[model samples]
Each structure stands twice: as C-alpha cells, then as structure tokens.
Target: MTPAARLSAAIDLIDIIDAQRIPAAKALKEWGTAHRYAGSGDRAAISGLIWDVLRRQSSAAWLMEDDSARARLLGMLRLERDMDVATIAALCDGGRFAPDTLTDGERAALTSRTLDAAPAHVAGDYPEWLDPYLAKAFGDDRAAEATAMASRAPLDLRVNTLKGKREKILPRLSHLGAVETPWSPLGLRIALGADARNPGVHSEEDFIKGAIEVQDEGSQLAALFSAAKPGEQVIDLCAGAGGKTLALAAMMGGKGRLIATDHDKRQLAPIHERLSRAGVHNCEVRTPRGEADALSDIKASADLVLIDAPCTGTGTWRRNPDAKWRMRPGALEVRLKDQAEVLDRAAPLVKPGGRIAYITCSVLPDENGDQVRAFVARHPEFSVQPPEQTASVLWDKAEDFAKAALQSDEGWLMTPRRTGTDGFFVSVLRKL
Candidate 1:
C-alpha cells in the first residue's frame, strides 16, 4: 500500500480505539483480519503510525490545536517523523485510498505551532494528573524524563548462560544487527525502525536450542540486583511467566535451589515451557491451590526472595502507550494495595540476613521508593540495602552502574533517559 493509504488506515484505527475503547492491538488485528488484502508491510506501516500518534498524543493535540485523529497524525508527522508541511499535504491529498486534502486550518496550525507554551503534561505526552508523581520521582526534569520514555524502545535479548555465552551467540544472530547492551553483560539489543515488524527470534536456531531469551535490559539488571549466588536458596515470589526467574537461574549457575511461584496460576502456565526451553533444572514450579500455602515447606529459609511486584507499569509506556492513556486513579490505588500485600507476604520467606529484592517496572515513586519506604516501616526487621552495596556483584562496573542510575532514598531507579532501558526500580532489603 502507498504511505498515504497507510496513514488513512491509522486514522481509522485511532477512531475505533477512541470510540470502542478497545486496545490498539485488538483493533489492529481485527482490521487485519477484515482487510486480508493489506500485506504485512502495509499493516506494519499502519501500526507504526498508530503507535507514533499515541506516544505523542498530548503533544500532538497541543500542537495542532485539535484533538481529532487527523489533527494528531498531522502534528505527529511534523514533530515526530520530521515530515514537512508539503510532504504531509501530498500524503493527505484527496486521491483514491488516501486521506482528504489537508484543511487550511490544519496546514496553518502545523506550520505555526510550537510546544513552548504547552503545559508540562502536554509537552511530555503523559497524563496531566501524573505530573506530581513524575515530579516526585524526577524533580524539575520530569517532563524531559517522560518525553524520553515516550520514544520507541529497542528489542533486547539476554543470552542464557545456562546454555551459551554472548560471544558464541553474537555471531549466530549477526544478521539481525544485534549489539551488546550498554550495561548488561548478558544482554544484546536489536534496534527497531518505525515500521519494522518484530523479528521472529523464537524461530531462530539459537533460541530453539535454548541459548537466548527476549528480556528487557532493565529487567535483566533488576534480576541481577538480587545478587543470588551459587548454592543459595532463592524464592521468586511473583514469578509471572518466569522472565526474571530464568535470569536468576543463570545467575545461580545451576547450583542453587530456586522456587518459582505466583498467586495467580494463570500467569504461571507459560513458565513451565519457558523454564524447560531455557534448560533450567535447579528451579521448582509452585502453583497455589485453594486456601493452600505454596511455600509452606520453605518459609524463612530462602537466601533471596525476589518480588517482581505488580505495578502500574508506567515505565513500560515506550512499548504500551495505550495503557498509559487507559490507566485510571483507581487502578493505581489498587496496585498500591497489591504491592503492600506482596511485600508483607514476602517478609516471612527471607531468612535472617537474607534479602528481598523489590522490583517494579514503574517510574512512579508511589509504586517504587514510596512503597519500599513503607515496607521497611511496617517490617521493622528489614532494612533497605544501599543500591551500590547490592550491586557489588557487578564488580568493577558497580560504581559506573550506580552513577548511571538515579539513587533515591529507597533504591536505584533506571529510566529510558538515564539507562536506556525500561523504567525499573530495584531495592534490596535485608532481614535483620
């Protein structure tokens, strides 16, 4: 399809998302099913346009001086894609299968507008209600931080040391332009273009042979912060789908006992296969039954209890822009309650001198530093470990890692702007 047609499709999908209140993925899939004539490239281009508009939603609306789908696309083309007015007009020309000709108002607005006078939230492309929370986390640089998160994210992969090393796998996947990640020794990053379809890594022989796993660099780093060692016992308290559990397994080097369990059994389903594929053998999977304690046999015996805690997922906005717009105040409140419950539940599982690594893929202080502070308050036996102290496992890189991340009172915060990873807050707390 022509680029103009792809733009029209994006506008149509945006309207459906706004009216039906459906997820962008669902709408895009339905559109694809109905329009089978649209090839893969067409679908990819359309999806890219849709996501670009969503990422810059507030800023686009502010610049165009209109909140309509077309206006947003017009503003996004100018500000995000760096398309000049003439290029945008040619695409929106009243031709067959193309969007209508740009209105005089749209053209003038696009040509003259600037974000200099817009509110922080508008300029940052995030909800206005979240300003205070962002402020608390990032101080005067909240807008700049949020804007960095609003950009597209690259696909990251972690080499499974249980099966292979980075040097061995790098040459195997060289065609994909995978490069070593900045901070993670085990991570490889594949940069993505605006309309690029996600590469089928699962189909690669290396992945089939259990040498690589698609994990965010930030998540890999968060799991590393736990400092799980060989022969130590670790409990992955919220091992949803076992992403970090696999990382923990690699860190343990097959000498430790790792118990992976989640309160929600549905999230545990895919983990069994993933664990097998990653060639992990020292880990046991625990599924909760009605009114039963899954960890009864292991209470207060674990050297490390890792809680990849449930959160608002604000830090993942680079990948899931729709969720940011759909999130509500009530949802955040519910997440806060969940975090407290998980923290309390994890408190009993850590042995004396053992640590609980509290992690969240959220930039909000309420889910991160604030939650850690409150947890330590309620559980007086536990104290927050300095991020630098916990990250000592990184050896010579520890000081550099500490400098790259934002150190709050409770832990280290990694953001897209700071560490070029998804937003994550990691704090290791030791039981006295």
Candidate 2:
C-alpha cells in the first residue's frame, strides 16, 4: 500500500476509536479483521500511523487548530514524522486511494504553528487533568519528562540466570542487534524504529530454552532492589503473571522459599507454566480461593514481601498511549484503595527486620511516594529505607544511579527522561 493510502486508513481507524471510545489495539485489530486483503506490511504501517496520532494527539490537535481525525493525521505528519508542507501536500494530492489535499487553513497551521505557546500538558501530549500530578512529580521539567514518555519505547529482555548467564544468552540474540542495557546488568535492549515490528524474542532459541524473558529494564531493577537473598523466604504478594516473581527466583539462586500469589486466580494461571519452563523449583504458586487466606501459613515469617502494586500506569504511556486518554479520576481513586489494601496484606507477612518492596509503574506521587508515606504512617512498625542503601549494592556507579533517579524521602522514581526506562517507583520499607 502507498504511504498516502496508509494515512487514509489510519484516519478512519482514529475516527472509529474516538466515536466508540475504544482502545487503539481493539480498533486496529477490528480494522485488520475486516480488511483481510491488507498485507502484513500494510497493516503494520496503518497501525503505526494510528499509534503516532494517539501519542501526539494533544500536540497534534493544538498545532492543527482542529481535533478531527484527519487534522490529527496532518499535524502528526509534520510534527512527528518531520514532513514539510510540500512533502505532506504531495502525499495528499487527491490521487486514487489518497487523502484529499490539505485545506489552506491546514497548510497555514502546519507552516506557522508551534508548541512554543501551548500549555505543558498540550505540548507534552498528555491528558490535561494530569497536569497537577506531573507538576508535583517533575516541577519545572514536567514538560520535558512527559515529552520523552510520549515517544516510542525499545524492547528489553532479561537473561534468566536460573537457566543461563547473560554472556551465554547475549551472543544468541546478536543477530537482532541486542546491546547491554545501561542500568540492568542482566538486561539486553533492542532499539525499535518508527513503524518497525518488534523482533519475535519468544521464537528465539534462548527464549525457548528458558534462558531469556522479556522485561523492561526498570522492572528488572525494581526486582533487584527487593534484595531477595539465597535461603531467605520471600512472598510475591501480587505476582500476576510472575514477571518479577521469576526475577526474584533468579536472585534467590534456587535456595530460597519463594511463594507467588495474587488476589485473582485467573492472573496466576500463567505463572505455573512460566515457573516450570524457567526450571524454578524453589518457588510455589498460591491461588486465593474466595475469602480464604493464601498466606496464613507463613504469617510474619517472610524475609521479603514484594508488592508490584497496581496503579494508574502513567509511567507506561509510551507503550500504551490510548490508556492515557481513557483514564479517569475514578480509576485513580480505585487504584489508591487497592494499593493500600495490598500494603496492609503485605505488612503482616514480613518478619521483623525484614522488608517490603513497594513498586508501581507510575510516575504520579499519589501512587508512589505519597502512598509509601501513608503506608508508613499506618504501619508504625515499618520504616522507609533509603534507595541509595539498596541500589548501591545492585548497580554499578551507585552514586550515578542515585543522581540519575529522582529520589524522595520515601523512595526512587525512574522516568524515561531520567533513566531511559518506563516510569517505575521502588520504595523498600523495613520492619522496625
């Protein structure tokens, strides 16, 4: 398909998404199923256009002076793809299967419009309602931070030490141009270009042999900060799909008692297969049944209780841009309640002098530092641990890591602008 035709398709998908208020993934899948004649390349190209529009939706609308699907596409072409007015005109030349020629208004806006005068939220392409939160988190640099998060993200993979070492698995993915990640010693990163499909890491020999697992560098570091040691008992209080649970198992070196459980049994389904494939024998999966207590047997006995708490997921905007537009104030309220509940549940599980590693893939202080502060207030027996104290042992150039991450009285905040990672907050609280 011609690039012009792809643009037209993207505009149509965008309209459907706005009208139905559905997610971009659902809209793209529906479009693909209906247009079965479109080849894989054409579908990929169309999908890329749709996502680019979503990521820059706010800024695109601001520049075009219109919020229509077509206007957003034209603005994205200029702002995101770096296409000039002349270049964009050629693509929209009223040719067959192409978008109509841009109106004089659109041409003027494209040539003269700039984000210089726009508000921070609009220029950064984030929801306006989130401005206060972003301001609180980043202050003067909130705009730059949000802009970085609106950009595309790279694929990251963590070598499963339980099965093989990074040196051994690193060479196997060399064909994909994998490079060592900056922060995670066990992670490899593959840069992705605009409209480029991610390489199928699951199809690789290392993945099939259980030597590698797809995980973001920030997530790998969060697990490392838990400091789960060999022969220690650790409880993954919210081990949905076992991403971090697996990481903790590797850190334990197969000598610890690792219990993985979640409130929803369905979320625990995938953990069994993942644990088996990774050859993790010391880990156990616990699925809660109704009001039954899944961890009653080990109360106050765990050396570490890791809560990968649910949040607004604001930090993952680069990968799930549609969610940012769909989020509401009520959703954040619910997450706050859930986070508190999870923290309370984990409190009784950690032994005295043991720790609870509270984590969230969110940049909002309400879900991160604020939540940690509240938790400590409610649980007087627990005290906040400094991020540098734990990060110093796990990462090289400990001082550099501290400087790169935004540290609060409660924990550390890693953002795309600061750590080149998905937004993640890690706060470890030790029992007094």
Candidate 3:
C-alpha cells in the first residue's frame, strides 16, 4: 500500500474506534476483512501506523490543533514519522486511494511549529485525570516512564518447565535469535527484525508441544510469587485462561491439584484446551454454578490462592494503547470496587497458614499497593509476608527489582519501564 493509503486506513480505523466505541483491534480486524485486497504486509503496516498514532494521539492532535482521526494521522506523520510537508503533500496530490489534500493551515503546522512547547499532558499523550496517579506511581520519573511506554514493546516468551527446562529450550530457540531476558530466568526476549511478522515461534514444535508459552516477563515474575510446593493444593481464583495456573502446576511438579476458576465462562472455557496443549494434567477447571457455589466447600481449603484481579490495565498501555483512550475515571472507580470485592471473596479461600498472592496488571497505586494495604487492614489475621522469606520459598528466583521492591512488607510494583516487562503488582499475605 502507498503511504497515503496507509494513512487513509489509519484514519478510517481511528474514526470507527472513536465513533462506534469499539476497541482498536476489533475495528482494525473488521476493516481488514472488508478490505480483502490489502495484503499481509499492508495490514501489518497499517496496524503499526494506527497503533503508533493511538499511543500519542492526544499529543498529536494537540500539535496539529485538530482532534479528528485524519488530523491525528497527519500529525503523527509530521511529528513521529518525521515526514516533510512537501513529501506528504506530494503523496496526497491527486494520487488514487490517497488521503484528501491537506489544508494550508494543516500543511503550515506540519512544516512550521515546534512541538516542544506543548503541555505535559499533550506531549505525554496521557489522560489529564491520570496525572495524579502517574505522578504517584513514577514519583519524579513519570515523564520518562510515559515516554518509554509510548514506544513499541518487545515479544517475550516463558519457557514452560512442565515440558522442558530453559537450558534445553534455549538451544532450540537460539535459531530465532532470542536472548535470555535480563530479569527473568524463564523468559526469552526476542529481538524485533524484518521477519517479525512470522508467528512461527508460537506455532513451532517446541511451543506446540508445551516447551514454552508466550507470556510477558512481568507475568512470569508474578506467577513465581505463588510459591507452589509439591503436594500442596493451589487455587487460581481469578484465572483467565490459566496462564499462571499452568505456571503454578509446573512449580508443583504436577504433584498436587490446581483448580482454576473464573466468573467469566468464555475466558475460562479456553483454559481446558490450553492446559492440554501445554501438557498440564494436574489442573482442573471449575465454573461457579452461581454466586453461592463459588465459595462453598472451598473456604480456607487452599494452601495457596492467587487473585490475578481485574483492574484498569493502566500498566499495559504500551501494548494496548486504545485502552488509555477508552478508560474513564468513572469506569476506573467501578473497576476498583470490583477488585475489592474479588479480594474479599477470595481471601477466605486461603488456608489459615497458607498465603494469598494478590496481583494486578495496573500501574496506579489505588489499584495496586493501596488495594493490598486496604486488604491487610480489613483482615487482621493476614500479615504481609517479607520478600526475603517469600523469595527463599520460591526457589530464590527473583530479579533485582523484585528483591528491592518486595523487600518492603507491602509487596512489589513491577513497571514495564523499570523492569522491561508488563506492569504488575504482587503482594503475598499469609493468614495467621
């Protein structure tokens, strides 16, 4: 596709996203289906451009002094893509399937003004409502963190211990030019290249046979906090597709039962197939017949209960930039309330001496550290476990940031900017 055509596609996708209130990915997929003439490369390029624009849409619009999708697309080209005014105008000049010709003002803004003077919110491309939260999360480094998150993220994979060890799989994956993730022993971070479009790694014999699973390094670290032991019963209270449940099962050496449950049947339903594909046998799926059936017979029965609670997903803005645009303060409040309810309901499932690992892929303190603090206050019987003790129990497998952050009684906050992985917060509390 021509550069102009790609810009046109991005404008169309963004409009659909803004007008229909649909997700960017879904909108892109639907657009692709309707435009079957677009080849694989065309789809990839268009998707990349769309995501890039979304990541910095607020700032891009501010620079262009227009908020429409086309304006944003042109702004992205001017600011991010670094295209000159003459080049953009030439591309749009009477070309078939090209974007409509730019107005004089639009062309002038693209060629003349400096964007360095824009406000922090516009330059950072984050919502104004999130300023306080981002400040709290990053302290003095919020701008740097936000900038890092605006860039594309690398692909990460976790070596599944159930089928093979990292040592054995490392040799096989060497052909893919994967490097050991600096912080995660079980994670392999692959370098982006021209052939990055190939999904061969996930479909390879090793992945198909459960030697590895595509998971973020931060997620792998969060799963490690479970500290599953042989013959110990574990419950993934909010297991969505059993990513960490399978990790816990591997930690248990497949010796104990791992029951994975979730309120969303559609999400949990795929776990059975994934578990089979990963060669995970000890894990079982349970769908609550109703609200009453969820807590019955399981109160204080699990040696370990993992609450990978739902949240605003502020930490994953890099990968899902559209989420930042769609999120509202009201919706975030509702999610926080839902998270608290889930924590309260799942707390009782941990045995008296057992531990509960509360986790969320959120950067906000209210959804992470603050939530755990509140949970601890409500349940006097539960005490925050020291990071050293938890680390020792989990085979001493912790990154430097994990050791430092988890050293506190509250737990650890893993950020993508700091840790080069997804943002995750994990707190382990033991019942007295």
TM-scores, all models, native as reference = 0.98, 0.98, 0.89
Q: After superposition, how far is residue 197 of candidate 3 from its true place, in Å?
A: 3.0
Give the worst 10-residue stretch by lDDT in candidate 3.
191-200
Model 3 CA deviation exceeding 4 Å by range: 78-94, 99-115, 193-198, 388-399, 402-409
Error of 1 at 160 (Å): 0.3
Decoy 3 TM-score against native: 0.89
Residue 293 error for model 3, in Å?
2.3
Global CA lDDT of candidate 2, please? 0.92
Query: Predictions ranked by lDDT, top down?
Result: 1, 2, 3
Question: Against the unseen true structure, what C-alpha lDDT does each candidate score?
Answer: 0.92, 0.92, 0.80
Which lDDT tens digits does candidate 1 get at residues 1-432? 999999988998999999998999899999999999999989989999999999999999999999999889889898788889999999999898899999989989889889988888888899888889998888878888988898889999999999999998999899999999989999999999988988889999999988999999999999998989999999999999999999999999999799999999999999999999999999999999998999988778889999999999999999999889988989999999999999999999889999999999999989998898899889999999977787787788888888889987688899999999999999999999
Instruction: Score residue 397 of candidate 3 by CA lDDT.
Output: 47
The lDDT leader among the candidates is: 1
Q: Please, what are the lDDT tens digits per residue for candidate 3 over residues 1-432?
A: 887787777788888888898888898899889999999888888888888898878777887899999888888777666789988887776578888888899887887776577766677788888988888877667766776677667788988888888887888888888889877778888766321354578667898898888888888888887688889989898898888887888888889888998888777877887889888888878887755565477868889989999888877888888888788999789988988898888778888899899888887888987888898899888888876665554354454565444234677777766778777888888999
Score residue 86 of candidate 1 by CA lDDT: 95
All models, RMSD in angstroms = 1.2, 1.2, 3.0
RMSD over all Cα atoms, model 2 = 1.2
